[model samples]
Target: MEKVILASRNKGKLKEIQAILEKFGMETISRDDAGIPEFEVEETGTTFEENSLLKAQAILDEAHTITIADDSGLEVDALEGAPGVYSARFAGENCTFEDNNRKLLKELEGVPEEKRGAAFVSVITMLFPDGRKLVARGECRGTILTEIHGTEGFGYDPLFLPEGENRSFAEMAPEEKNRISHRARALEKLEDMIREKCSC
Candidate 1:
């Protein structure tokens, strides 16, 4: 099987990407697994695509192999996308998931439910040692809830309800959420691009 390095240390994300890549007969491993030392890459990009490429390129520079990276976050329209690229650090650099959620709730306080529009976005970038690159983006539109719900998922999952759904992403089963998640959609597009490239 083809081996690829995923430019992330998050185990939850690694598992998700591994599962998807496995179907394409590719084995996914974290940078640590590939013997690359853990390090932080400052996300100086103003957009998801830029950040994703930054991460993938950073790892590829170190490992000189096929690497995949993604930058994803919640964009709240009510906050004028206040947390767009800063979703992870919305509360602060050292913030925890709960801290971020608390900040979001406080900011949306008194905002009518109808005006609490938001979207989860994911941008995936693949980089090869030969300098080849592929990128894909996906979004899931929804509204931000006044309170958190469900026990599953991380980040802003509990506070965002996908459109046409009564339950938050945290409320759904893992498989169910993965089916319609922004990351999943982005990976699907990435898979198509990979297949096309392989055939070329």
Candidate 2:
């Protein structure tokens, strides 16, 4: 089995990636497991793809190995893609998930159901120590609920629904969501790329 480095400090993200890649028997090792020092990868870029590349390249520089980095966020149509790149700190610096979700709901209070269309966008960038790189993106489109729902998942999962699904992302179990999430779609694309172009 080939080991890949997922350059993220968030444990939730690590678990999510692990579950998604497990389909291909790809195992991921985070900095926590590898005992590598973690550092801030400033998201100076304005797009998820750019930020994903930034993190993957930074980690590859240090580890000099194959690495995968993800950058994702909720993009509300009404907000003109707000909280896209700024998803982590939408409320402000040091913001909590609730803080961001609350502000988003407050802004969409009067919007009609149809107008609340939103989607989760994810970009994954892979960097190989040999100076090769690949990027893939995926999205799940749906409307923003008037309020939060469910008790699973993280970030904006509670309010965002996938098309044709009555429940929010947060309501779905990890296994269920992993099968259809924006991250899952992107990972599937990444897996295809790995097999076709970067197979070890």
Candidate 3:
């Protein structure tokens, strides 16, 4: 089976990516598994696609392998898409997931439920050693709850109520959330691209 490197240190993200790629009969490994040293790649991009490319390229440069990277965040329509690119550091650098979620709720304070529309956006980028690149984007539209719910999921999952669902993402099982998540949608696109390349 072919091996692909996922350019991320977050275990949750790595697991999710691995699970998706497994369907293609490809084995997924992280940078650490490849014995690549950690180095910071500054996300100077103002958009998720740009950031995803930056991270994938950074790892590809070092490891010279097929690599995938993703940049995802929550964008609240009422907040004018605020904390979009800065979702990881919404509350501030070094902030925990709870801190960021807290800040989001506080910012939306007094905002009526009808006005709390938001979307989780994910951009996935794949870079091959031969200079080939593929980019895919996905979005999950929903509303941000006034308060958090569920104890599962990371980041903003607890507060994001997906359309056509009463439960937040954090309340759903991992497999259920994976089925409708922004990342999963993006990965589905990526899989199609990969199949096309292989057939050609």
How well does each candidate superpose onto the true structure, as a TM-score?
0.91, 0.88, 0.91
- Steric collisions counted per model: 0, 0, 0
The candidates, ranked best first by TM-score, are 1, 3, 2
> Residue 10's C-alpha lDDT in candidate 1?
84
lDDT of 3: 0.90
Error of 2 at 68 (Å): 1.1
Kindly list the per-residue Cα lDDT of model 3 for residues 1-200, writing each as its tens digit. Answer: 77889888878778877776777787889899988787889999999999999999999888898899999999999999988999999999999999999999999999998999999999999888877888989898999998989988889999999999999999999989988999888888887887777532
Candidate 3 segments whose C-alpha is farther than 4 A from its true place: 19-25
Q: Model 1, range 1-200, lDDT digits (tens) per residue?
A: 88899998889878888877787788999899899987899999999999999999999888888899999999999888879999999999899999999999999989999999999999999887777888989999999998999999899999989999999999999888988999888988887888787532
User: What C-alpha root-mean-square deviation, in Å, does candidate 2 show against the real structure?
Assistant: 2.3
Q: Cα lDDT for residue 195, model 1? A: 78
What's the lDDT of the predicted structure labeled candidate 1?
0.90
| Residue 128 lDDT (model 3) | 81
Per-residue lDDT of candidate 2, residues 1-200 (tens digit): 76778898778778767775676677888966766675788889999999999999888877877788999998999999988999889999999999999999998889999899998999999888777888989999998999989989888999988999999989999888978888888877887887778656
Task: Compute the lDDT for candidate 2.
Answer: 0.86
How far in Å is the alpha carbon of 105 misplaced in model 1?
1.7
Instruction: Report how far residue 187 has shifted in candidate 3, in Å.
Output: 1.0
